[model samples]
Target: MSGGRSAQAAIAIILAGGRGSRLGGRDKAAITLGGERLVDRAVSAARDGGALAVIVAGPAAAVPPGCIGVREEPAYGGPLAALAAALERPEAATATETLLLSCDLVDPAAVVGRLSGARWPAGADALVLRDPDGREQWLAGRYRLAPLREGVTALGAVSGLPIRQALSGLRIAWLDTAADDVADIDTPEDLDRARARSELGAD
Candidate 1:
């Protein structure tokens, strides 16, 4: 992968430790939408986006080759804990920023491109996407590594910590996208929608 200013200094951290209770206990990382496993798609997106390193915060079984796999201290400790675990890795130490993503995203590559190519504002600690309903998709954001590490440190115990609380003090820059590029699989119905979108070449 060729590196650029934004992507070259970044580390992609993929959160894949969800319990998937709504998907009949299926592993979201292994789930396929349009014949591609979600975790594999995430890794491809990170590499294609030119991230210096890729880290999958999930079970070893879900981690693909050429990527680092790490588990949160308490398995299934939620996204914040997964992110905290990723930040502790040696790979993250040299990165200036982080591409925080979830393994369930239907179009991870598109989202990664959007974030990596966008003009990050000066003094902002993060650049996050806002879905159609105006809800912030925290996991679909790019964050300054220093601030993220500081935030995790301040939280002390990251397990079970709410994501919003964990990143409470960061200055954010929001990107509003009209498409469902940030849609993620959480249920059978969601999976069906993602498949339909994929087949339609919407992604």
Candidate 2:
């Protein structure tokens, strides 16, 4: 609550809302890598990134034990839908800022760590990570809560507003990192690449 930013009360929503449709209906959240389920890695990433609480937005029954799994409002909609559902939750209903995360990410902890230590300008509304290219990885970004309604409005007008477009006109921190900044386990090839990269980094 330091002048509208969370000192230690930040809220984050892990958008584990998808069913991994592209992965042939596998539960991407539960997929394991390096001896732990994918969701666990994502959770750890958020916690490590400084989220006090993380709402696993997906099927309640599928969430692993010890994780607070809440049902996504519209069930497997778009990223905007997932964000809207998170805002409805009591925690985000009054939150000043919420960092949104995607489950299929391979290095949740890495991304979170970089983002957790990020600095923003005065009155910043969102902190985003972008690659050297201009593609906005909205799924892997932090956003302020006050403009959440704007995100909702954008989603309604479009099938799915790009995460960056939703935060237009707000003070934003556009972070630039390597291509791995927003990498996720979306497909078999993506998974293989991530694993290979992990192996390379370890060596």
Q: Which candidate ranks first by lDDT, i.e. highest? A: 1
Query: Model 1 — which ten-residue stretch has the worst lDDT?
Result: 1-10
- Per-model C-alpha lDDT, please? 0.87, 0.71
Candidate 2: stretches off by over 4 Å: 1-5, 61-66, 153-165, 200-203
Q: What is the Cα root-mean-square deviation between model 1 and the actual structure?
A: 2.0
Deviation from native of the Cα of residue 64 in model 1, angstroms = 0.4
TM-score of each: 0.94, 0.85
Residue-level lDDT tens digits of model 1 in 7-106 = 5577899999999999999999999877889999998998888777899999998999989999998899999989988988998998888889999999
What tens digits encode model 2's per-residue C-alpha lDDT throughout 67-151? 5667644566666666666677777766667677888888887677667777666767777778778766677777777776675
What is the Cα root-mean-square deviation between model 2 and the actual structure? 2.9
